[model samples]
Target: MTPFVIVAPAGAGRVRLLRTGDDGLPFTGPDGSGLFGAAAAVTVEGSDLARTVAVLEQAHPRWVWDDTSRWYPSLLAAGVRVERCVDLRLSHAILRHSTLTQDSELAMSLPGVFTSVAQVGVPAPASAASIHTPAPHSTLFDDLDDLDELAPSSSAGFGATDPRHSDRIPRVNGTGGTGDTDGPELDAVTDETPELAGRDHSTEDPEPDTLEIAEFRRQRDAIRTATDPSRIALLVAAESAGSLVAAEMQHAGLPWSAALHDDLLTRLLGPRPPAPGIRPARLEELLASIRTLLDDPTVNPDSPAELVKSLRRAGLNVSSTRSWELKNVDHPAIPPLLEYKKLARLLTANGWNWVDTWVREGRFHPNYIPGGVVTGRWASEGGGALQLPKQVRSAVVADPGWKLVVADAAQLEPRILAALAGDRAMAAAGRDRDLYDGIVASGAVDTRAHAKVGMLGAMYGGTTGESGRMLPRLARAYPAAIKFVEDAARVGEAGAVVTTRLGRTSPRPSDAWQDVQDEAGADNATEAARSRARSAARSWGRFTRNFVVQGTAAEWALCWISAIRRRLWLLDASTLAPTARGGAAPTAPTTPTAPATDLRLEQRPHLAFFLHDEVMVHTPAHLAEAVAEELRDAAREAGRLIFGDAPVQFPVTVAIVDSYDQAK
Candidate 1:
């Protein structure tokens, strides 16, 4: 078997496979070549793709593919699982923006191509307008003028043209500075195959898979030239592994309880009131009590404007219907009104209709968008996976005979700070205990609350109130740790980039921020412009400050989850058969998609849920202890992989429970 087999799209939704040399360089053409080797193609014709892939899977070759999420799902549906893959999309984003690869011209010339599928077509998150990530790898997509028009032949400096040149490799000018070579043309990659994120390439403006080979090569070259090659390599690999894990977690749907969900909702919201888009009985009763107390039955508590008007008319002198503001008015309506609004939000957000739409067949298959947040935290596209209401956790019960082994890193950020800064005092403080308590023990703050607030203020750029007061004490106690964020804040305030420990970079300030700064500097600038500039600078600084810790924490999490994922695969497969479906109560009617095989999820341990800092693995009762052990071992391994012998700990709170609520 070859060292690497690239599974890339050929054209029109068809895929082709090419074998690379022992060095992992892709094939040059169709027939076996001295540079790259033999090739095979597979069109998406019914089950043929899966069968072909399954044959390839037996070789245990490292699959070099585009975005793992986009391509792997179909293969999974076909029940084909590969050993490993190189996610060009995810890796491209990392290398393009990393501080370590700033000298690589590939990061500069190739901009605007690394947009994820979620970023395309769908309405982008508000953060997208302000945050910009790295460039795209031109391997599996077409249509960019910068990437089109030429192939990267041996004469172009990848490998020599000699037939006996198996040892021939690209020459990279490392140690001194970047070489002045017109880096390999991206469009010149194999065929017209284009791999993209989430979905197939758009025909109207296809980004052909021309530069994939070159891009992958350039990335490898960039890493070779990076200051910290091992860390960057591990970070990239773990991120790719994370992509695979994310896809699998989504594919293996979490067992949801439609009946229990209905019961919980019914008990809380009074039987899902008969009228559509109407408040429940309990909520309606609260609203009635609120209106009567305010002496305004016509108030319409649902509308802030009407509620405020009625409150003012009642002489309560409230400026708004916000609970805090209303509470200050000494009104009898405030308490019940707040309660009503709280329950009303749950009913509207995660009520019966929401359950019906998202929770299908006893599984809530949320679309997990990895690296979705600017700080590298994941965001859910549908089903509000990240925001599962505590009220509805009973719905997340594991299949019977299975248990949930949930583990969450405790004080992850602060511990990361200690390791990143090499702050021995701070590390010692957090040795075997809560970081906040450690800070208090070290006499940095008066209480645990103050310590936590101070740390939050430091990381989040809070410079007023209690945080402001405690900041000085924290700085005095742990200058190295505080200085890490302070330095990041300064760099961000200067409109520069700050990278996480593993090279995921914080985006540079937006152009609008620069314009505001320039306006503030100009003689004709108004106070508004100056105020805006200051605010913008401060906001960006806070983002960068947290970006270092949060982004690194995210990296740690990726490593943790990926480690767990790999370990779980090593365990013996359970022989238990699939169980019957449940979840058709009148209030909660769902038809969960049953297991496709005899491998019952309850019998074999698998990751069912992952929110930042925490994860829940569903496993048979017999394997619960092993899963918990793997979770801890993974946490320790993540710390070692990221920090490499740093004495700081990233301990996780572990619990084995029948339900998610029990774990908490």
Candidate 2:
């Protein structure tokens, strides 16, 4: 079977498919070059694309396409799902900036279609309005009209047993503190690398089929000739598979109960207001109490300025109304004020308006952007999917005969550091138990708190207070792991670049950053200038210090989901009848057979949601254990694939429950 089939747009509302050899390169003729057009291509109408794809998919070819988001959604809407793909857009973004491919022509050449292609075409993060609006293009998500395809399936499976593997961290409020600054705000050099900035990728609609074919070949050649060919190849494949997974998750959508969500909101914050811009009953009550206690009846609790004035008037010395800052205040109004803020946050982030816009027909579809963060972590376009608040997690209910298999990799970043650095000591510390506990047992630190604080400091450049004091012992116990991040930090301080385990390169420091460092080194440099330069250097150091581990962890996650994707497909296939597979039936029947329905995404165990180190699978009740095993096996396989023979164990805390909140 051919390894790849190139899918490209053809004129007059049709698409062309071109088969490629096992190496993913175009077919070569007598002259040793690929054929240009008609001789090697098959064109089909736009409406028939899904059927043709379904047929060709039987060969298990990797669908080579320009952008997965642009092409895959419609196919999913038509009840077709591909096993794998070569997302050229995502691949170009990784290769061009990657140090491993720096010597390749694609990396050295001036930015052109590939650079702009990576930039200009991607969607901006989702906003409230955009989620409800129709997609701008004709061939995009507009065809996703069959909402029933996303409905829960029948419960014909066996009962599932709950298995608790590990404990989970509680839901904390307000985006946990940043290590270096202890707050959200941090001053750091902006990355405006010339290779990544400012260019128009505007091109003729449906680039020539030959161009895509040649581009895919170029990318393959670049990967094949890289210094670490096998590792880079694995990285690219995993990254591309992540693109497929992201799209599939969006299409499948997470099972959500709007009724449950509304109940939770109403019980916590009072019923929804009768009209827009009006406070709910509970909020109004809280506001009245807060205003009366502060002796400022007209002060708007929602307005920070007014609230701060009122807090001071109430004899509390508070600088800002941030929950953390207000938590220490002992005034009677403080309690109601904090409650008001919490409930207000619920109303704003995931309240009634959120449900109306993001959730449709019992499923919440957030536009997930793969490799959205520079460190390769995903970011959501709008629906704030990455930040699904714990306050509303109870609303993430599984379908009646299905369960939500939620799993979080315990201490993912630290374990990643062990594998990346090949530090046997560090790896052993996390081998079969909680990494922090192992650290304590190994005498690296006195307590789990010290172990965690020390490790966090090591990775995040924390050098003050308790974290600073604990670092000496941690470094003494795990020199290799400590030295690895320290070296990365040093390189970053010097304005050099750093690369992840699988070749995702860190963007170089901005020209402004270099200018600041240069100014500080001048013969007559002022003390203030030197101090500013040192602070700037440390900030960038912190970024690079964490980049290597975080990026590699992201790669591991990609591989984990990719492996789970294939495994779940096999599981789904195993349970379905022959005729039900891909909606195919026997040409001639000896006996009557049930009418086959296309195996939709919701019909089988599918990835419902994914954050950096956690994933939730919505699966049939009986397959919960099997899906849980698949997740564990995939995680182990991910580690082996990325860091061969490394002693580090990536243990996941799996919880199979009926609701997402219950798992946590």
Clashes per prediction? Answer: 21, 3
lDDT of each: 0.66, 0.71
**What lDDT tens digits, residue by residue, belong to model 2 across residues 285-371?**
999988888878777888899878877777889899999999888888889989999999889989899999999988999999999
Tens digits of per-residue lDDT for model 1, 1-664: 2345566666665665555533345433334322122332223433356655555454454567768887888877766765567787887777776665656644554354554533222111111001111112111001111121122113211111111111111121121111112433222232322321122222221233445555666666766665444445656776777787788778877778888889988898888777687778898789789878977779787788987788788887777777677666666778888888778778877889888888877777778888888778888887888998788887888766677788999988888777666678888898999989999988888899999999889889999999999999999999878877887777778777776766666666666888889999899999998898989988888887788789889988998887787677555443333444331211122232444333433335778889999998977666677789989988987776565445688999999987777877
What is the Å distance of residue 356 in model 2 from its true position?
Answer: 0.5
Candidate with the greatest TM-score versus the true structure: 2
Residue pairs in candidate 2 whose N, alpha carbon or C atoms collide under 3 angstroms = 125-381, 126-381, 126-382
Cα displacement (angstroms), candidate 2, residue 562, comes to 0.6
